[model samples]
Target: MAFHRIFVLDLAGVGMGEAPDANRFQSVGADTIGHVAQQWPGDLSLPTLQRLGFGNIRITNPIPGIPPVEQPTGYFGRLHMAAQDNRRATGLREMWDYTGPIRTESVFTTLTAAGYSVTLAGPFLSYLATQTPAERFQVGTNQAAFQILYDRLNAPVSGLTYVVLPEFRFAGEQQDLEASAQALQMTDQHLAQVIHDLGANDLLILTATHAADQTFGPTPTREYLPLLVYSPSRQAGHALGIRRTLADVGATVLENYGVAPATTGHSLLNELTQ
Candidate 1:
């Protein structure tokens, strides 16, 4: 059977549980989509990567460093502080692209190779502020954007689509467990809408790259991560245990569509489809 479409919702840096009473945070490399694809179940991850059809695209990874870069040696060195602040305002995309390592393949590219059309969607902070200028002082979440994205995704596209929604991007500096839960709810609600619109015959997969209780070191660092999967095409269960590595996502997807992933990962597709 030829799988027609696929949709993925990727919420960046959405840590697991509640925020900790700590100072800094760490961003483990495995949490990114690329790493997740590497661990897909079976050997499907490899051939799939070759079929991605993205061409020779050079995607940049993000990096983080200070004191070493521009030590306050002189006036210009002091100005680096302001430069760092500007970097923060640009949003996490650049951060991940510049400082983050290329540990895994792109999730978007992998899915495309698997023969499923995909569409990644997300909201950047600066863009959100611009959209709702009046709500500059007020905190913003992906609730509204999630609704719009879900509606669009479920609106009967010509083929399968992958949509990534970084709910964490909407949560600004407010790092709280409630924020994480709210982000999940926001994701579920939009997904529910899509499922309702598409019906049970269509496939639905839900998962997270990693979880964060708080920052590790005021910058990104290697840390523990978790992954979740919910597919109507699979089993009907609520509140399943978390997967340690995000790579399992690829394996599970391949199994669901009857195509083996090219990489190695835990394939919970059996449980999900069970």
Candidate 2:
């Protein structure tokens, strides 16, 4: 099941939620995709991500410029983080199925150990923040930084290319709604290049680390995170019919390389194998 390459882009601090414990976290009104769109006159337009089945994910609220496709090119869905803490570390660890105490290894660590060249960029926080890889670049704390690197690379990138985009929630926390929306748009542009240059066997993953707040509409509400996966050589499947949690991310990544999954989550990639 080993693939030639896997790239995971973390859109930090974005959420589309109905979190299981939203009420308790005072985030019951959070909707990263919807709230941002509400600011603009029309839905946020992202034709690039749209073609990748970004809009195909099932949700009560959909993002602008990405309405569900009649037929999607990749696996699409949303995932709840499965906890109320909602910290960046917590969400990232969930992807690795790290259930605490035993201190499980991360997907990044595992991949690096298995000899995959891993590169991390931008201000996107990492649960395995301590692990240095074969190569690394500092993209600072902005969305545009990542885009700059993406353009420089221009050609198809190999290895586990993990890039973290700026957190819209940071701007949202300052109640600078416009700035947050602009940041989201910037990431969309970066993604367009990614979708355009994907190699035949490369795997692409675009997801939020956690649902960070964007004013909560001057009040409070629940939280939700977005999840998406694309493979240029996908063998099967379309929209994910069932709800998914972040744990599935780790499972799917491991499964792609024929590694055994943790006892926790199941692989959504199962639907895409030829």
The number of the candidate with the highest lDDT is 2
TM for every model, in the order presented, reads 0.48, 0.83
Query: What's the CA error at residue 40 for candidate 2, in Å?
Result: 0.7
Superposition TM-score, candidate 2 onto the true structure: 0.83
For model 2, how does the per-residue alpha-carbon lDDT over 1-274 read when each residue is reduced to its tens digit? 5567777777767777557677787776566666667787667776666766767674355666568776667677777776556556677667765443466666766667777666666564344456656355656566555664565345454456767665554575566667777876777777777666777777888887676566664322446666778777874337665455677777777777654455567777657655
Per-prediction backbone clash count: 58, 9
Model 1: CA > 4 A from native? 1-5, 17-107, 110-115, 124-148, 151-160, 170-192, 214-227, 233-235, 238-242, 257-260
Give the per-residue lDDT of model 1 (tens digit) for 79-163.
0011122223322222111211345443334444655444444444343233221121222346654654565456665333333
In candidate 2 the C-alpha lDDT for residue 10 amounts to: 77
Each model's lDDT: 0.35, 0.65
Best by TM-score: 2
TM match of model 1 to true structure: 0.48
Residue 258 shift from truth in candidate 1, angstroms: 5.3
